[model samples]
Target: MSHRRPLPRGLRLTVTDEGPGFPPEFLPRAVDRFARAEASRTSEGAGLGLAFVQAVALAHGGTAHAENTEHGGAVTLDLPC
Candidate 1:
């Protein structure tokens, strides 16, 4: 976790997985409602997890981010403390 400097009084939380990571094309829409990576479509999920996370961050006057790391995917939520 990290401090939100010059932005707000909050903390940024990040979660990452050591999986195949997300597709490049899906990065832009990763936080969209119901958006899911093709590899996850076959799994059990409604694809709203990230969307909900983003919504909560926004509601808290913060933001959310997603990205594919060298070894996996990462999702981050910045929220007011």
Candidate 2:
């Protein structure tokens, strides 16, 4: 995992990890609750991580995204400081 540093004042910070990225089509819907592109009753989660992130960002007047990392994959969050 890695993080951007020394954000300007009024900016919130976030970190990202390298892993299997989700599909591009799913990007638009990633912030929705229970909105898993790979949703499965047999899986562990109830599809809430991205949604939670989105909620936090929104609450802080910002946004979130999931994307393919140059090296792998990552999730980013931007929020008001």
Candidate 3:
């Protein structure tokens, strides 16, 4: 799912997926480089996706956040309009 809304000084874009959410312990460090939820390191990612998102958001003077809903996970990027 995707959603967009206007803020006072920016726009918020939220993307949600229905896959299993990130592990509970991984939530705090979700934006860190090479931070993977899978302990075995067998997942398909190098764990840089969220980190890249965060970096891009910061470079644009914005912010990124990750959270879990009842059914899945959501990432929200708030960027300057």
For each candidate in the order shown, give its overall lDDT on alpha carbons: 0.81, 0.74, 0.91
Task: Supply the TM-score for candidate 1.
Answer: 0.80
Query: Which residue pairs in model 2 clash with each other?
Result: 10-81
lDDT of 2 by residue, 1-81 (tens): 757655575554555556667777887887789888675547788789889988888888888877776666567887656
**Span of ten consecutive residues with least summed lDDT in model 1:** 1-10
Name model 1 segments beyond 4 Å from true.
1-8
Tens-place lDDT per residue, model 1, 1-81, is 233243357687878888888888998999999888885366888789999989999998889989877868888887776
TM agreement with the true structure for every prediction: 0.80, 0.75, 0.90
Best by TM-score: 3
lDDT of 3 at 38: 80
RMSD of 3: 1.2
Number of the candidate with higher TM-score, 2 or 3: 3
Q: What TM-score, to 2 decimals, does candidate 3 have?
A: 0.90
